[model samples]
Target: MQEVPVQRQHVGGSVCLLRLLGGDGHRTVRGFLGGSLLMNCKYWHGDEMKPTFWCKLGTDSDCAADIVITSKNQSMVWRERFSIRDNHAGKLFMVTTEGLAEGDMGTYLCKVQRSTTQREESYGVKVMVSTNTSAAMR
Candidate 1:
């Protein structure tokens, strides 16, 4: 992975926008069946007070159907097998998915909702789950 500098700009009074200069906002992750996967998403400093969302990619590639969403004032949110924790000081959030299965293999989106004036920033993640048949056979 290449290292990119974090750019911060004031969109308006008290609102900041963070952008990564030379990187595509997509990632591919592999996990074993019945295990867990963790994804880290970074955002702007001012976005700490904003809401964060984690959702399976909808048919139209939108986050219309969210699996879990964090409150603006809360640091953590959980729903069923999905959980999201926001680290304000670090300007990043972590999403954990438990009980991985074949059905969990798909694209997920992590989004940080900005002020109404600015569009939300989203990161696309592709999850691939596989089973270790050899280990199961043994």
Candidate 2:
């Protein structure tokens, strides 16, 4: 995979803007085991009408196994332990994963599906699950 430049701007709390030049970039996120994690991914303004998806990166480097998919008509979509919300006005999307486990430590993808002729725009995210010793004690 080719490396792309990334610009991060804090957007309050756990939210941030991940700006990528060619609409693709890599980022790292951490979450406590048995807790949750939130990831925000930015996209071009005009692309907001398109569908957005979140999934663990598969061997083919595509969203072959989608965790959650948000429709243009619906601002949010939830499935099992995963939820995705699209903020069309903000030109960004937020994905939340709850009840994290050790197996969740891997690469994920934030993708936008475009016209059939166009390739999907995506942002790569690496998730790391850390154990909370204090919580484990209790």
RMSD of each: 11.1, 5.8
- Report how far off residue 27 is in candidate 2 (Å): 0.9
Give each model a TM-score: 0.77, 0.77
Query: Please, what are the lDDT tens digits per residue for candidate 2 over residues 1-138?
Result: 343434332223222223332334567666556766777777777898999988888778766698898886887998988899998988878888878889988898888889999978888888777685333222
What are the clashing pairs of model 1? none
> How many clashing pairs per prediction, in order?
0, 0
Give the range of the ten consecutive residues with the poorest summed lDDT in model 2.
Answer: 9-18
List residue ranges in candidate 2 displaced over 4 A. 1-24, 133-138
Question: For candidate 1, lDDT tens digit of each residue in 1-138?
Answer: 232333222222111122222145666666657666777778876888888888888688786588888987788988888899988887878788877789988888878888899988787777777685233212
Residue 134 in candidate 2, Cα distance off native in Å:
9.6
Candidate 2 collision pairs: none
The C-alpha local distance difference test score for the whole of candidate 1 amounts to 0.69
In model 1, where is the ten-residue run with the lowest total lDDT?
Answer: 13-22
Q: Candidate 2: global Cα-lDDT?
A: 0.72
lDDT to native, each model: 0.69, 0.72
